[model samples]
Target: MKTLYLDAFSGASGDMFIGALLDLGVDIAQLRTELQKLPVHGYTLTADRVAKSAIYGTSFDVVLDHGEKDHGFIEHHHAHGAGDHQAHHGRHLHEIVDLITASDLSATVKRHAIAIFNDIGAAESRVHNVPLAEVHFHEVGALDSIVDIVGSCICLDLLHVDRVKCSTIADGSGFIEVAHGKMPVPVPAVAQMLSDRAIPVQQHPEVHTELLTPTGLGIIKEFVTEFGPLDAQSAVQQVGYGFGKRETGQFNALRAMILTTSQSQKQTAVGHDQVTLLETNLDDQTAEGLSFAQEQLLAAGALDVYFTPIQMKKNRPGVQLSVLVPPVDRDRFVTLMLKDTTAKGVRYTTFERTVMQRRFETVTYQGLPIRLKVATYQDIRRVTPEFEDCKVAAQKLDVSLETVMAAATALAR
Candidate 1:
């Protein structure tokens, strides 16, 4: 499977992501053509070359023509384009999506683009205590945001990779000023968006000032399937840097890694050394739906899936849909739920995990086949029958559990 690994060493931004996509072979002409569908009063998606710390790289910029703003046009220093401009602050998210839908873009791209914004809109609503339709985007409601969303969809579709993964986002430390006044590092909506999606994030003390922006977070929250070191299935074809504006000690470089298929299948590792656990309530779904969802999640690359009964908000009882996936896959799983069931919320957090090396062996008992689990420790292999397999075999043979156990023991010896 083809894969792309994101190395967010410095941080990520919408524009820088576009630049990186361009560097990784995304057709700029195609992106620019699709971006023209936004139907904004007047704006153009422009490409340029800019230098960061004396290193020259491609930079994608959004150029706005005078419409209803204060200046003849808006020009910002950051490559991602200026955040929700002062004039466009109070517009509704649906209004923005509706505008994008009327554009001359592909239906698939348009649908994914809208879903990406809806994810951000939902985050803003939950954080600000308002309905999604009433939630006013602060940083992600601008025309530039539309370009980022649509362009990102186009780029990913062009790459045609089987999986997308990321490293634990370095949400730098320190405060950033927003329209709502000075807010702490990460701001409220951005932090809540990541947390609500069950995505894993960490902070670096040396660097600060919102390394992960709402737009950047929204893309990951919408597209990536798993988060871990670049255990990719292909060779690294290209590396691109999407420089952030702020300087964070010596680690102020935002980088992305793009990979293409080199062989039928290969392994690549590139993420943080942390683990995350994601769970959601599922009382309203049918048993069939729940079962299907579990199968789908595992098929979508989940590490594990299980259920537990629990009391939810408002004294409601429901089965908790728990999933153990790499932090990056968290978003993909969430998307899975949105499409598969009626669950309204999902919860997740970082947890410590220890993994042992594994191997498989076959053992026979009275001409019955049994699969064995083997673990390696200090170069020694320990073998044991798969418990569930033994139980099924015992019932089919009409034998006692002890009979199965004894048979397994004799075979191992």
Candidate 2:
């Protein structure tokens, strides 16, 4: 099968991702024609080979026609300079989903686009604690992000890529002021998205700016299977670079490479990522307190959490708390661990972990929500519903949890 690997040497954004794919030989005219199927209007497509920091690559853009009156183009408010020419861009998650569903795009392309948008919506929902459908994509719901997403999908379909892998993602540090006041760099949605997955990431040492956008991370999360450098077994077929808007450094570009992979490599490439492992010892905390602490750690962007039984100093039985997290989220989670538990200190280490590429599907049982998860390996494929979703259905049906789980399992099968 064919494979595509992304090299985010500097950072990534919606424009950079699409631009790189265009440089990888996706026909520009055909991409424009495919995007025209969307119900959105008042925007013109633009593509060119641009240079940043002396590096050259294709730059893709969706130039909004704010002057047009036919598509209800109202003057958008850019309170913090994010709305200057970016007017009427904010739309709810459900609205965008319905728009894509109504478009003339192919069913396969539509599914890929919606799945990406769902990822972004899920991240926003977690960051704001709002319903998935109710999350307003203030920055990503705009015309360019919409085009970037759909156009990327169309190009990938045309290229016939079967798998995707990426290098360690690079992001910036410090604060970024946007439409919703000043937020920490990387943005809450981007940070939350990185936390939810096993994608390896690092902070850009020089620039304190918004390097990776929420839309960009969402796309990466949906398609990228493994995180790290590509293996030497695959033969590279093509190479392309997508330059970002910034010209501060040579790392301000994303590189894409097409490769021919052997079957053995595909089976072994499912999940490989770098993460930080944090541990602490606690003896005085109650069971209820530990449960709440775990929930808070998850919300604060922990990858995994668990406890182990151990004998502390003086023969006292205690629990050893373990937290798996991304390096970018180390400080925040560490603070929570120190504050929430009686432990005055913590121990941590960084290592690489491999996991299977997972997919999520939501099914409804008599108006109750049930989520199905699919995983891939060498020859084994696993499908199961999220336990929490099954629990809720069980309560609604007044049935045993195991019975509800089995019913959901049968439906998934």
Candidate 3:
């Protein structure tokens, strides 16, 4: 499996993440062309090699155009000085969603960008005690930050990263200024987002300034699937450093790398990873309640949730609720299981499982697009058509579902 690991020893920001991807060999011109699909304007993207404390890396910046001839609107806005920039560029969540949804960019890119913005918006909404729709994105909604968020997603797509892993994030202490006045390090929104997701964070008191920005946290929260040290057995394909603007009296950069782990390395079928299994026995809960709890657990990010019939004490029929979740999310899921269900206690165990390498391909059947999930293990491969796509094609072609699925499966094979 191919994985992208981010070593945020210093910290991360939207610009820093993009710079790292660019340094890792994402084509700058292609990224620019892809970003042009968005309706946003009044900015120019620039990237250059920069050094921080003897460490060299790429520094990407989105310079808002204030030239009289090129951007009369931005020039007029700039004439009011930095104080009014927020008022001029600040956008609500729905507005940003509309902008991304209307773009001609690839669906994957659009989904990623909007998800990041939605997370940030949710954090901001919680912090300010405002409705999610009424939450205004002042700094993140600016032209540069928008480019940073969306541009980072575009680069990841360009790289075809299968999974993202991050190290323990290092954030600083003290206060930083925001449009809402001075806020403590990590800020309210960043803190809220991290805590809500239970993302691991570390504080570096030596550097009394904010290291992690809200945009950075949003990006990490949206894409990163795992958090821990890099695997020692994996092979490192390439490494890139993304320089930050901070002067921390030490190297201030985010290290990103591409890593590959093959089946032969671990003598496994394809790949192996650890997961947390949570189980609870329930006999007092209603069917309606159990169904609702299952829905809630799935929505809360549980990898899998199912109920199995089992006999319990008192000679009564009962069900065993099992949930699969990432290790980092064990506590969060445990809390949800306890709260959303009638179980008095939940048991969890860590299990190592091997999984097949999976990839997706789209095929046209009867003029309708059907997606195939291809999984590989050693020299063996399995192809399965996506059920939803097959169902749609069957309805559109006035054919049976099984026929559409079989045809799609054969085509994929």
Each candidate structure's TM-score, on Cα atoms with residue i matched to residue i, is 0.59, 0.59, 0.63
Off by over 4 Å in 1: 54-56, 67-90, 249-253, 261-413
Output the worst ten-in-a-row residue range by lDDT, candidate 1: 69-78
Looking at model 3, the pairs that clash are none
Model 1: lDDT of residue 174? 75
Tens digit per residue, CA lDDT, model 2, 364-400 = 7767878777677768888777888888888888988
Cα displacement (Å) at residue 399, model 1: 60
Tens digits of per-residue lDDT, candidate 1, 268-387, equal 232224566887777688889989988777655566789998897888888988887777667777777777778877788977664445555678876777877656655676666777
**What does candidate 1 score on TM?**
0.59
Distance from true position, residue 160, model 2, in Å?
1.1
* Stretches of candidate 3 exceeding 4 Å from the true structure: 67-83, 267-413
